[model samples]
Target: MVNMSTSQSNTSLSNGTAALYPAAVTQRSGGETWFEVGRSKTYTPTADDIGHVLKFECAPSPSPRRLISVSGIDVPGHLDLDGRISSGGTFTVLSYNILSDAYASSELYSYCPSWALSWTYRRQNLLREIVGYRADIVCLQEVQSDHFEEFFAPELDKHGYQALFKRKTAEDNVALIVVLEAKFGNHGIDNPGKRQLVCVLRSSDGNIWFTSVFNSAPHALLAMGKVDPLHPDLAIDPLGILRPAAKLTHQLPLVSAYSSFARVGVGLGLEQRRKMDPATNEPLFTNCTRDFIGTHDYIFYSADSLTVESLLELLDEDSLRKDTALPSPEWSSDHIALLAEFRCKPRTRR
Candidate 1:
């Protein structure tokens, strides 16, 4: 565990408005947690007024403890943690690809028939829930244009979040990236390709780059020659396409494979059914598991930062583990959201 201690001098404002600063406490377990001392108010803060002070305390276990103090009033607020210090001198940053939108046909099936309606009514509520997590920066995937134009745009504005989206493609697809004004000043947008959107966030602590990506191809499934004797075309390679956008995110590129259980073989008959192998009754339903070592595979790469280690880790774990269990189809959209966290050091000046 790590810990930090911070201090600031009080200052006055010229507009006759004095700011009330809050001391913040941050912790990390499965996800990051943050606590603040005061509420939000409109006021101009002076150089002397300490808007926020953070203390980090590092403790490995229950016994002995050691503490470290990070100085500089211009530091970014997100890096301030009560314990566990990073040399980069920035706040904790988190990014996730939220698969919130469902297909129209799936919606009609009543699994989540009211998804769009409920999302419309509670869009602000959803944004509030995300903000409550206290993540300094966020990158959202699968944000439909209609959803943003009608709901998320105005709702996020209320919270002082500035958003920049990629230009709409011929497919009408776009990804949204948002940054809080309090911590970082907006630099601009970086368009790597049609499917990837990038932005640079500048703060006193450091300049952080964020990217959002969505792959265009569907996942394919492999079939053995004996299993599909009728049609050779019925068999798919199973190894899906990898997106370049994954490279920009500075983490392993994830390929979301949509599983299918539909059969493409000969139709079942009363007499022939008896001869069929019981195990072959539902070939499409069989779970898939694969392992790769020292080779570049279709779904992932061999690069240290770009390898899909987390996804492979999930597949390696036992299904009984609650954390590794696949989410029920009724609740989730077509694919599961994959996430990874990376720590970056502040760039030095010559």
Candidate 2:
């Protein structure tokens, strides 16, 4: 059944006035002829409408007769990396920061249409895309506290997902963690400004750990020993005001799943290079806005315990900027979601 919502576009007509047209009437290339299947906003597809494009159209006014069309279930742009892991103990993890309504301002996302930016519109869009991925675990940031209690928690529960929510004190942004299967342990770590959720799952080999972090600082680099504090380009104190006497580093063998996975030619490895930053090898950009575009979200795993089997191909910048920035009709959030499929590596016997 297709549920048509007029929240994205303002309409003067009554509910039953909108039309649902099966792909048979609409031209797949571009032109949409007005052959109406039903006048009601809800439509159920028949076997005959199998291969055609379905579109819904509504006219706001009778005088000028302006028609606005909403496309129906177009093919997603990402490379389909299905069935890559043929065997034992594989799971997928997704990390995303669904832009909070508080921050989804027209001034900030001026390129985005008002109807697309509305919480009513974007919330449904985000949920549809998120559920479609079918990840074993989902970590979402910038989820408002109210939304966690009212909307996301109840809705996801229907899909057999259990969740953990942590909100920053006095901040509208909250961190959400969800797992489809049983988990060994889960925890939330509160940093200076942002929150991180870590999920630990038990495998026959060892404990497989995954984390969703929204960090703008270079702390991840420090922990991995990838950046030198003394380098000319690398500042001893990036924030400047909080310089320390000694450089900070960690002993954890944490690694970015995207960087650790090597590129290949088939279904799973399809467009790996195009998705990554040429220099950093990370995603080209996770957070894209009108003024700022960069990677602020990451999914890290214990490299020694897990091996990446597949990754969801990142959408290119050109596609993202087609509507000037994110929060566009196609994408619900300013940040794009990142997903990786991992398998636990067998432990060596002593």
Candidate 3:
């Protein structure tokens, strides 16, 4: 479902310099499901893995690329990913916005056709896309409570993932109403509320990257004017609401000791752009049954001590905001998923 390219460079760690850090390959007959995120054999590194590290990264599905072949594995043949708490040298984090079922009744649903929008259909499709990524840490936004308690939580649990949910502040009313209404609702709550989910994971070197759904790329652009004159969507005014939102979210005054970094969707291919929520103007994605398009999602890392190796094949590479007609055959959700690879930088030993 995603396309990827690879690049390899030799950078060794000795000591002193600290950086936060963060997949492997398999060779098999064409057309078979070569790699299954939690069920298949990814790799079995030999003695060659003692000190050398190889990173394999990809956004899975039918069209998957090896992405990397380093010092030990995959040079001569294919190998599976280690999938341990750490992968010898790297770890991956993924951010996805899977559209919730409650609000999936809009025009977008009709376009991809009603069947694909059905909970049964989209559920499996979303699950396939999500698990296919095989990320160590996954941050999800807009998940409905029932779906979480029933579907995602239990499903991901089978794969050794521990799920945590951050309930939105506005959903308190919806729950109370749902309780009062009792059996009046078909799917429990007409408005199931949106939440954020994070998958806790460890890296080979024990480095952690707090990559999540907050829009944190505002600071990375460094516009000459207070706002980004070049990029209108990212533009800001001296006292605009976004300026403060950006400052509080990305600056992390209390956590300044940690480094921070994010990538702007500016240069990303057009297809990878996000859908927009007509109400708040956030990208319509991660939940499409809504409307509009924009890249309101972002991944931030503690730049002080982390090193990002690759942010691979973003979906919707050529699709842009002007094309917000969701429920398309190309994407199951209004939003597209973003995958990034990372690891702790090797330090210069004293």
Best prediction by lDDT = 2
Off by over 4 Å in 1: 1-87, 91-109, 113-117, 121-125, 171-341, 346-350
lDDT of 3 at 207: 12
Each candidate structure's TM-score, on Cα atoms with residue i matched to residue i, is: 0.31, 0.60, 0.47
> What tens-digit string does per-residue lDDT give for candidate 1 at 87-172?
43233233333344543233332433343324432343345444544444545545678677656666566777676555334333
Give the RMSD in angstroms, all C-alphas superposed, for model 1. Answer: 20.1
After superposition of all CA atoms, the RMSD between model 2 and the true structure is 14.4
Quality of model 1 by C-alpha lDDT: 0.28
- Go through the candidates in order and give each one's C-alpha lDDT: 0.28, 0.55, 0.42
Clashing pairs in 2: 23-53
lDDT at 131 for candidate 1? 55
Better of 2 and 3 by TM-score: 2
